[model samples]
Target: MRNNRPMSFPRQQARTRRFTIGVPRAFQISPDGRRVAFLRGRDGEDAAACLWIRDVDSGAEHVVADPRTVGAGEEDLPAEERARRERLRETGAGIVSYTVDDAFARAVFTLSGRLYAVDLDGGAAPWEVPAAVAPVVDPAISPRGTAAAYVSGGALHVVGLDGGGDRVLAEPEGPGTSWGLAEFIAAEEMSRFRGLWWAPDGSAVLAARVDDAPVARWTIADPASPEAAAQTVAYPAAGTPNAEVRLAVLDLDGDGVAEPRWIDWDREALPYLARAGWTGPAAGGPAGGAGSGARQDVVFTAQSRDQRTLRLFRADPRTCEVREVLAETDGTWVEIMPGVPAFTASGDLVWIGRGGDREGARRVLLVGGREAGPPEGAYLRGVADVDGERVLYSASPAGCPGDVELWLFDAHRGTSTPVRVPPPSPGGDAADGTGEDAGGVLSGRMRGGTLIVQRRDMDTDGVRTVVLRAADGGEPDGGTAAAAGGIESLAQVPDLPRPRVRFWSAGERGIPAALVLPSWYDADSGVRLPVLMDPYGGPHAQRVMRSRSAYLTSQWFADQGFAVLIADGRGTPGISVEWEQAVRGDLAEPVLEDQVAALHDAGKRFGFLDPDRVAVRGWSFGGYLAALAVLRRPEVFHAAVAGAPVTDWHLYDTHYTERYLGTPQQHADDYTRSSALESWGTVNRPLMLIHGLADDNVVFAHTQRLSSALLAAGRSHTVLPLSGITHMASEETTAENLLLLQVEFLHRSLGGAAGVQEAPKGAGGV
Candidate 1:
């Protein structure tokens, strides 16, 4: 959420609203469709995460019992105690949230690596199922909703729905099961945290077992607690040994834990199982006719570390055998492409690929070398079949508006063919392309011989369940009216303005951003306005994608006539692993280059933008980016507002810092080049920095060093350390004041009409 908007913002046009804590997160629709489960957490110090379920139709809400019986974080404590706790939880609340309703809904939430289930019908408090010790994270229910599977305490597990029991099905063999190690290697390297999956019939679970026992663990003093003891976290820095990962399947039954069938791969090969799940049994059995026990094996992707090689492996659960049907490799890195389209009732596996010919080398590969596969002597981007024999898969590049494509693959022949799915009707900006925008999450199901694909269009802000009948075209399930309304309400957050996705090109990546234009904006009128470019430049930590920030802040920016931009540059998540890892050892270059490019691009494209009127801003890692953007590219930006930024990696906490930039001792040059404190003299742009004096994540020393270095370099900059403001703010006033100060900085430096604005009144928030 953008921090400051004037009263004229779009939200203000509707109504003035009271401040509220806790925006809903981890929203999960129940299997019965009668209820929606969500993780409800507080904001700032007043914030702590808790499980809460709501009646989808009635809007009734109930707080799921907390295992620690810690009532809503600060809400359960006294005033003085609340204030004290706020100080501790600001940097981060070590709380775990959940979403049940997958095939296995038995194990709902995870607490400190342990599994727990809450009654959907509202019975006793949450009960802990101690089958494992570590966090049973990212639990996936089977397609029939009988078993829930998760990665816990460095092992894969399955729990029965009818209160049968929980069992450890598979643990990384040999060196994979080291103590104090985080879960899978994919979760760390590829950043795919949910490391396991449930099959369609709940008969088997496909899991990614990562072995990182060889990687070294780094220690960092807890940033949230200076007087508190130091805490060590496992950090696999760049070029360091990463966890070796593999894919395995466990037999799921009411019987005891079945043996794990390892997918056949070279033992020396570090093959990453990026995606896995059963495609239901092969349609029509061996002869393409329906057969009860004739389900085809599950399909998974075996990728290499640099992400160069990809092999599609098909494994039969009954036989416990695996075979590589299709293989693709790249000298640089091959993108197996995450979030591929789902399969149809006809057993066609539609997915996106980047190599081959057909669409012409130039036309096929767009940003970051992405393109459709070779066509009839051509290529396709939206669809392709990795295992097709002749015409394995086809693609719809042009007609398919959204970034997602529809494909049909014949497993036996190993060929792919694209299916022409109708585009969303001409409405408010239809779903266009898969690139970085358009597609949110695609959920598909086969029913009554119809392959129904549920596409959530980020562009249209709508979700449609399209039904493709018998390989032929059919009407969408939700239809027009219901689909439109559901899409709107699903994204229509209460007391906030709808977010917009903005794009700009940086280096080889098409950097994407979410923008909230000022509510008072007049497009036709050439009114040069101030802008705030907020970014989070950490590796895989994308802040712009559907994130709920403090109290209607974007509305505040809109009201104030400041164009708020949240850019997910090269290193940000939601893109690819190569794009994310590229920032390693060169953190500031990719991010700084992108911010400058975006600022200039915005000015050139939008007539209302003031060429000289731009301010860069962010918090934590974002704050670090803001400091670097202005200092490194002072020509593009006028001012900067950095909140709790890590001025130098050498002095910051080791775990997170070293993970991206490596140890200061190992990559001394990169650490020095990426550090703002080392180049404080270049910070000639107008700078207004605010930080929590008690921030542990980014020690107050970061600000102190920046303040001192700027002074020594003879560079003038403003500094404000919010008293009692920990690294994070809980109360509304904290965010409000932050926005207020930020807007003031933008006004002074970006040529906001002098004397045109009055001082912001009232405390920042409640």
Candidate 2:
């Protein structure tokens, strides 16, 4: 039930943005694996997200596109599709994403900022392309499904699909330039949310221009609209000036607006482009220059603005030359690996590097550069799809760094395996009906031999999906294998209770922890309870994972009676690349010493934990490690809430604060040993801080410069702000009264074991 009164787990995890609205997510299969597509919500309180498809031999699930049947009700989007759905933390709302045609016979997307498309073999009704251009950001669909490429108002258009060729190809040559979107350090720290790509014979696109007039602007305001005007933002932060980003190609088999061909490099020594596209003509390499043999080439990867050199070029879209096939250096940075500059439909070169040295490094993958599978000591994580010579990826094994799984690989049998799911028919409890065990946290896709997958564990609560394939000509039913099924999750769930977590490998560098408790805690009733921790604990992300929606809001803060814990420790990630470069130059002491060593090793192996009623909460680098665990361990955290925190690593963002503190102008003591305003007059506990007066990623000037350095060191705390929030307090009554005012200020600053009660004064900020 989406809610029928009596639904509090912070209002069903903020009306399910956390349980992720109706769960089926961006799948997209169809290269002859009989159609698949995805995106969900016709339930689980449906906050928009429609698209659908599914028919692998009559499993039928259609609904092609329905932003309320294309009238696009009340979405008025476009500040570049609301900053590309706030840089893809995409809190759903109608077709959150799409883009299909590589003969997946058509699909596009975008609703409020226009453009629609739709035709995956027609059951029609999705028109509005009218040659796009009404704010359409990040479209794509052009493997010759006759033209699409998007991004408006900062130009790079190319329309054509029966709206009579709308063409602008690349505009914005001044005022914070732009051309094909994605800037703000390549979509918030290099996950590279595309600037544009297209050419496997859609005759060319490549893109990315970005300028942001040498960044650093900031502002935001609307502190409850004093007649509202503020906004500004170019931002960059930490050793400032970033948004220059270049790259080019253009041509769309041209007749007008064509002239681009740029693609140079050494952009002041690799200023983070981090990945671009095209190897097409089915990945068979070599072209455009050096004999212009042309089987499709472009490929990209840039990085090093002290991201310790990532480089992987190959370019040549008709002699805008490039070359460097592989580089990867590191003394401390280079991590940008997700799906990689891939290829392998026999054109080899599928890359992801760094193997053992700086504190035993190891993340291999590569396919033509060799060392295939995520073998020897696993932990890889990222690659998740190549699909012709296979690949797939995702990792976390060498001693289960919290179970992420998925595997596949193949490149013509240099083997890899581990994909699972096919179990249910003998008893029918899980090809989706939730018997889980494709182990925890998987994800997938694949083509022709089908696959799909999905998963999430701690024995499932939301996400399941499945699919599989290969059983069409009547297979030997218990021998030749292949034939799973199941995709139906309408998400909801967390009408709380049933979390009682535990997971282990806690202290002495085994770190990975979990804890959670209070599903009516009675660990043999020793009754101690009152700790909380809940870290994001830094580096990319992972808050103790083996999924059950990652402990539904840490078991709704352990059913609100404390004892939560969580942790990943040493600079996070699936536990490698030297455990995410151990916060390279200290983003605050080994992440507040592994959340104070997993809260004193879970208060010495669960003796019902109270560790002096600790408390720590987070958001963004776990709200800078819950305000650095009460300004650097207030005798191991007596209280803190911190949401949107980055209490100044020089106000964040420069390819993630210069890949772990390097440019706060040449590591001003690693930004003063990771500034929680260099321990602002040691505010002894009960912190608070909440920020987000429109955060453009950790902005609100980092909780107004740590609440003006804790009121100029007179130290007391508690701030809140919020007006027009971002940095995902995904709204809904400020994510349900910021979890009921941080468990009523951790039970009024841990004075009484927060046995939770008082939570109604002005709720939580706007």
Candidate 3:
């Protein structure tokens, strides 16, 4: 219930800056809703993100050991020594952070390359699991919470909560080890990093093994020693032969050790393991009759290379046998499955697939029948329901942003009645012209004949707990009476405000954008605020309107009254692959033109936009775009911040860098034309460049090369080289300090009312 009046209020004087930036990142709530884990980060040249766990009921808290604190305790490291250590560590840092999201289990864990478990009760110290295991990441805990499974050294491993037995399940075969199963690479490329799954009885584990030995390897040099030599990196680009994938199950039969048995997925199948998980009991068969008198089921989806043809298999862990239950192929590439398929406790499979002949238009399907001919494109948007009797999904028919209707269909009954459910409007944009909305049951469970749905919104910004009757009739359980009103507006700003994302049209096609408004907004006053625009500008990618990220300080600056915009310019995902490849050849031209147009369009439509006070910022490839925007369209933005930006694509890796922009040798002119280094002479704005000396992603040379040219051109700018932070800095202390600098720089140039003093900085700011 919001005020409907559109009245305006008078201008007010500035107050103390009491705004929170960042989001409740890696947000996790224990299965029973008794505990939570999240990361609090800082803005600086090198970001420092720290982990914290809290009791959901009592609000008690404890700080997980920070990886940045490894080896050196607080106050122990002088600048130079710390830098040296950080550089060496960056070369191969394992899991420096772990987030727990165990809905089926109560106890949760956290690790900074080290395992530790915490009790769900009040204040408790995290018990460290003493082991130097290859950084256990992506812990997939069993529904019973007795054991957790994860990937290490390209093999699957499982650890118990009671301590003791911790052993590898799928060890690499013979001489040729897993091509590259290390951190960073696995987490970035393959969707699943710590790949491990639990059988229904929790007696076995299923995992994905990536054999990337056949891939081409290229070595990159340390930015500090660019001309010294090169270090090798095994990378496989699109169309190139990918790592052979295999599936195996670890039978942990009470002996506290995992027995590996490979499951036949047919290598010639050439299928990408898009989604896989242990199916629940029911659905009948041997899978439902594993050890411990418990029923166990396994399900996995494999999509072929061209992204067409999806094969779904149901496995019985007892016999290590896989039964191909469903398969679908399309003339055009079949739409990517809408995330992993949901398995009901009754063993009913639910998922979202496409057939409407257009992107963004998909249908909800309950995979009951075997023959799949263009899945039931009837019901629209959806979220996978792991255990729902009917296929429940979220849908809004082209004009509503967050007004999602929860539809339930009983394929058995052939009925498609939608259960009326209310959704928060992430933004009040009508669902017309490519505008997108997000909603779903955060996590729900059937307790005492009642269904509890935890609902949250990207629009209104908060989590609401609601209970519904099991029969969908009568008053909800506990006489709650449907919560007075289903929707409850939570705090947009907690200790750290969730990133505030909004959707607005910037260019032609009225494209959608995941924009963030400033934290300290004066909706009543009609004063245009400065803007910080970030455009991802890549393929199959999007900056969706969602909560803030741990690595971003967009809200912090917004807290200082500057609007931050992250628009998914034309070439980005969320639209179509056709739209994605449109700007492939054009390169920087399309992104730069669209964003600049957006600035003016935003200013004209929203009077609160200070068009002249806008600043552009990005990192990596995004940094390349940011540099281009300020250099090419200096009039659109007043300042620019590019961190570890790709000044020249020729120096980047072969896979992603060359995909859209051919080879540097083939398209020499395009490379030169699109590169920021070539246009450094035209960068007239107040540009601030930041890069980690040990960065291997875009490499420090990108900045080093550009800085030299800037100096030769006598263009004044600020350059800061972080000692050891890589492309993406995860340390909270460092990130916070970097954000503090961003705020100071933005405030100084944009003339915004500021509060906090500048954070301390180390050497190297030219």
Model 3: residue 364 alpha-carbon error in angstroms: 4.6
User: Evaluated with TM-score, which candidate comes out highest?
Assistant: 3
Q: What is the C-alpha RMSD of each candidate to the true structure, in Å?
A: 9.4, 24.0, 9.7
lDDT of 2 at 49: 78
lDDT of 1: 0.51
lDDT of 2 by residue, 1-766 (tens): 2443456667767887787888888887776777788888888878897888888777778787788878557988878788777877888887788877777888887778888787876567778877545777778878767668887788888887766678887788778897877886777776677788777777888888888887878788876878878879788887878888788888866466778889888788887787777777321111111111347768887877888888888877898778888788887777887777777666777777877666677888877787876878888877766766767777878888878777777766687767656555543324432233545887776766677777778765777777776455431111233655677777777776667787888777898888887665566766677888888888878878888888887776776677788888888788777777877888888888877877888888878777788888888888878887788778778888888888777777777777888887676887888888885434467788887787788777778888887788777889988888888888788889888787777778887654334222111111
Ranking by TM-score: 3, 1, 2
Question: How would you encode candidate 3's per-residue C-alpha lDDT over 417-471 as one tens digit per residue?
Answer: 4443233234421111211235432433331223334444554433444434423
Maximum-lDDT candidate: 2
TM-score of each: 0.61, 0.33, 0.64
lDDT of 1 by residue, 1-766 (tens): 1123344223332321222223344444443344555543433122345666555334466766454472222322222222223332422232344545442133365444455666656676766554544445545555554556666445566766556677777654664462112243443344344455555555666665566676666544534456865533334544555556556666765465557677766645634555555665221111111112447476766666545577766677667677776666655445544344334345454445544342232112221122224333232432221221111232223322113344544343333344333465455322322112333434333222233344544443324433333212322222221111111111223333444344444323466655666444556766666677777767635555432332146545554657777666677644443555567677788778777666666666766766666777788888898888778777777788898888877665433455466666677898888888765434488888888865544667788898998888788889987765566654455654566667766777776732224213211211
Greater TM-score among 1 and 3 belongs to 3
Q: lDDT at 423 for candidate 2?
A: 55
Clashing pairs in 2: 48-94, 49-94, 287-294, 576-579, 619-623
